[model samples]
Target: MKRIALLGMPNTGKSTLFNRMTGGAARVGNWPGITVELLSGKILLGGDMVEIIDLPGIYDLHGFSDDEQVVRHFLHDNVPDLALVILNATQIERQMSLLLQLKRLNLNVVVLLNMADEAKKYGITIDSKKMAEMLDMPVFLLSGKYGAGYPEALQAVARALRYPTPGMAEQLRSQLEEDAHLESEMARVLHHAVQIPVQMPEHLSDKLDRVMLHPWAGLPLFFGIMYLLFQGIFLLGQPLQLWVGDALGWLRGAALEPAVGWLPAIVQGLLLDGLYNGVATVAAFVPLIILFFLFMAMVEDSGYLSRAAFLMDALMAKMGLDGRGFVMLLMGFGCNVPALMGTRVMRSRSLRLLTMLIIPFSLCSARLQVFVFITAALFSPVAAPLVLFSLYLSSFAAAILTALLFKGKYQNNEPFVLELPPYRFPTLRQMLLRGWQEVSHFLRRATQFIVAGVVLVWLLTNLPPAAAPGGPDTFAGMIGSLLHPLFAPVGIDEQLTIALIFGFVAKEIVIGALAVIYGQFGDALGSALAQQLDWVQAYSFMLFTLIYTPCLSAIATLRNEAKSTGFAAFVIVWSLALAWLVSFLFYQTARALGY
Candidate 1:
């Protein structure tokens, strides 16, 4: 299949356009010498199945940064049949330099002036006909978010693909000599093709950013927004979660129990109770997972999330870390594994390592599921959101403090640069596609791992023919019982201890493990916990789960990406110690307070 490369600077709606073209059918993979991922999808274009690769957003093809180098190598080594150079329409005056430099290559190229709605809103207009005449290429004015002119854009790509290109090595050499001042000169020349508004009217995004980005207000405002998000997850998501949980239970009873009964007792128990129950328990949290990702996707698409990186830069600098590190930490709230991958954007190796160390502490949605589940089951509506929000704030506090301690240990000397996109209303199609992509990704990556862990735990708790399931003589029970004295101070019982052990594989399965061990599911499982533990111990348990060792995949990521077994080992060791110490302190302090 022929290839179409989507090229643009960061936050120029490149990814948005990619999703619009391919309908969110993206595969994420890594190429040589870079840990950053590449997104590509297959789409039918003009009677041919074409591969569209969304290259990393880079300002210059010849730039030196890691992301830029990836784009540069991909372009020169694996040159695509056509390049769709996407430009932010509002910022086209300055962004045109990138398109002009690529034009120097004399390849078949098309300029996609994206974000046309926002551009028009800003009273800016682009003469695509004039631009096409000057650049000797097609230019399409459209909104990637709103799906405006997408068909025409694809038609243009088809036309661009039909053309054969000539070498421009001499043109490239001349351009390279004048590259330093190219941006200003390009802006000056584009004056004929673009018109700007004088005395620009204030934008809604600007009005909001003034408060959201204010030095005195940004952090608190961020926290307030986060509190509401958690509230939404519980308040809005609880009904959906309950519905899903009840449906799964009904399916298990109506179909799985009867279907498995034909097998031998052991097979029936393993299939029905072990794997099915475990998987179902994890699946129950899918509602909240969907809700969180939906909220995040909308926030990201609207572009206010980028301002946060700027708002927190001073705080990050205090810890000798860069704003990019904090941005990766924010990404972790969606998924820690990808957030770890995002650290590749950091130029300094020390900063990357430090950021990698902090990402696991960023309260990923998996862990948040456990927290939200606990609060929804154990606390009042008014108190549940507060507790959930506290957990989030605590996670960030711990991550930042830990980064500060390691800041001097690993010295880094790279400056921070980030693009703050103008906020706009993301289309419902874009929002739904993003949410579905995230949900599918989670299920694809996590289902097998979680089911396996659940079955393994069930087996360990049920083995040895003479012992009862999860009883003292069973493997997990024996192990947990033996460690009871050590765990007792922190109020971790055998069932909870066993659940924590299984949590090593993935945090999302921890609750399912609890349900299996106690021979319960859903609300019954939460009821069992309520009967067994008091408020202090319950809080302590949540604390430990929050700070415990990174999940198995995250640990492997640290080892592979940091390329140091010792560092990965150190992370595990320190995390375990911290989890225990913090849980112990919280439990003890609560008791002393006479709660």
Candidate 2:
């Protein structure tokens, strides 16, 4: 199929447009020369099936950042049929430089000035015809978010593809080149075709920024927002989580158990007691994960995410990171794998490595699931959110402490630059889509690990035909017993020790492993856990989970991205050591306090 590449700088609504064009059917795959995954999907335009590849958002094609190199290499290797460059209309002046770079690459180009509505609201208007004439490319105004002028832009894409730009092949045969007068050319086009008010009316975002970006108030406001975020997740998701758990319990008792009743005892144990309970336990948190992504999507699309990054940059700078690294760390709240991969955006290896080391402490959804379960089981409803929020704070504290300790070792001198986009309310569709995307990602990637980890735990606890399941005679029990002395002061029992070990594969499996270890499922598992540990111990386990090693997938990504086994090993060692020390101290102190 013919190909069209979606190219743009960050915050240009490129992703929003891609989703609208492809109807959220895109698949993520790594291109031949690209290390990171890119989203590509097929959409029919004018009776022709064409692939749309969404490239990473980059500031400059010639820039040395990893994303820039990926874009540069992609254009060199894949050579898409047409490059549909999207520019933020309000920021068109600076964004047009990327369009100029693509032109130098001799690719057929069509430009869409996205967020036209927002631009117009700022008293900025562009004459598309004149701009098209000056730039020698088809230029159109579009609101990728609101669907304005999208039809015309689609038709323009179809026309550009139907009739390949003349002399393009001849230009492709020539060496890739650069133009020095990009700024002049862009200025000339803007002078003839765009109009901006001398004193533009102030925007609502500007007024909000006065408060949101204020140095004194911003940090507290950000903390408040995050506090509310956790509370909201617990309040909204608690019922749904309970309902999912109850449903799974009903499934096991009413359907799965009876259907497998005729099977052999080992088979039954493996199927029901191992696989079913393990996977089901992790699956119960899907609702909470969805709610989390939904809230994050709102914060992201509303443009407060960048504001938060800006708010944290000063402190981050002291830690040898910048605003962008903080953004990646926040992304870790969703999943550490992608956040680690996101470190590629930084050109500085030390900075990326530091960010990767810290990201694992960001309280990802997998750990969130475990924390949610523990907090709900151990604390009163009024205190549950507080406990969960405290875990989040501890995660950040751990990350901050890691940064402070390692800042001098992994030095980053790169200056921080970030663009704060205007705050826009995300549509309900966008919110729901983000939630679904995260939920789908979790199911596809984490579920297998959870199921496998739980099954492995079950076998370790049940194997050797003569040994009682999860008893001291079983392999897991023996191993946990061996390590119990090390963990005993921290209030982690032998059974919990095995769960922590399996948790290295994926934290979501912690709950599942607990179920298998206790020979319980769903609510029974929670009751069993409550009986096994007091509030202080439960909180200590959470702190350990919060600060311990990243999952296997995150570790692999860290190794691959850092391209250093030694660095990855260091991350593992430090995270584990810190986790143990923190948990041990907390458990010891809390016990001394007689809580």
Candidate 3:
């Protein structure tokens, strides 16, 4: 099988192109010595099996960042038969630098000027034939999103395999000297060969970007969009949540309850009561997750995220991080695992480490359930949103403050160079496919960890008290009491402390523990907790949950990425210490204010 490597800058639709080529069957693994994943897959072309490797999206090979190193090593060590350079056509000038570097490696190369449709909208044109002559390789204009002109690109790649030409060794030396001359030559060729339309289509995105990228208006617009997103999630999820809850209740009563044997009861409870119900609760948020991703995809596809980074650059700099780092932090709100992995986008080691260190403070989606369930039980509907907003706000504040304190000399200005792809209507098929992918991932996790967590909680909480006289004498009670003092300063009860302990294994398990411990409250726990605990205590719990040590998997990822066990240990201890300190301060202040 012929080996082919796909290389490009981040967010250049490399994944989309891979999915298009390999039918989304790529095996993603961490690149050697880096947490950034390397994607590999096989595709059959003209009865020949080709192994395709998708290298990490990188800007330049000169950087010492994990992603850059990954691409650099891969190219140097296991040279592929063909190097497919996917360039965002709209930003071809900047992307060409990487192409020149790859050319210097004396590898067979094919240039894919992707996002061609978007380039046209920007009054930009690329002459593939002319570009091919200049780069001394085949070049094709294509759009991965629209699936246009891909076949030609693939055929060119296949043909390149048959005729390998080596470039002159001195070409590398000349490339540095004549970069400006080469660009001018390429531009002149494009002018003669490619034609622009008399008038470009007017896009709503342009109008939106005008407002969204405004220095004074952008922040407000961002906040407004966020508020709508939260409201939309809650409104859309209520029905699905109730339906799943009712279905679980019916299944539990109808078949599970009638089982006479102990084995049957245990089996039924484990499968239906524990796994099914637990998964259903999490799955109920599918609509919301899908909607959020849909919006994100639109922004990404339309090339607005780059502009967002540009607008927020100053604010991010104030926090001692760059604009790109801000995007990773924003992603942390959706899920910390991928967000942590996304830190590969950062070019600076200190910046990436600091971002990873603080991401645990972001209010991830799993915690949203806790917020909604608890707030609804304790306070009015309006109060739930307000409380949730405050929790998210607190998390962001904490992240920024931590970054500022940890500011280091590594903070250097790297221009946020981004390609703004033209906006297009999102395809329903794509959205549904992506949504199902995430929902399936969530279901898998629930079955694997959450089911076991529920059973474990049931065993711990329902086990008979030790025959010894005191409450602390019981096995579970003793365990809870032992951990309670550590959490006491934060106003977390023994039960909540136990949940936090389980959360260290997996955050979702905290919900499972709560369900088992507080299920007797029967869906009213949220309102009940609000009434039972003061606002101050509720806020403190939320704060602690946000800043507490990440799950075991996250710690493992941190260890793997940082390449230092001591650093991982530091992350665990530091996060816990910070969580304790912050929660304690909030508790005291809130009490002093008599909340």
Instruction: Name the best candidate (by TM-score).
Output: 2
Overall lDDT per candidate, in order of appearance = 0.82, 0.87, 0.70
Q: TM-scores for all candidates?
A: 0.94, 0.96, 0.84
Write down the RMSD of all candidates, one decimal each.
2.4, 2.0, 4.2
Residue 570 in model 1: lDDT: 84
Candidate 2 shows a clash count of 0
Query: Candidate 2's C-alpha lDDT?
Result: 0.87
Query: Whose lDDT is higher: candidate 1's or candidate 3's?
Result: 1
lDDT of 2 by residue, 396-443 (tens): 899899999999999988778788899999988788766777788788
| Per-residue accuracy of model 3 over 111-219 as CA lDDT, tens digit each | 8888898888778777788768866778899988888998888887778877644533432232145568657765665566566566766767778778888889998
Best by lDDT: 2
By lDDT, the candidates rank as 2, 1, 3
Model 2: residue 323 alpha-carbon error in angstroms: 1.9
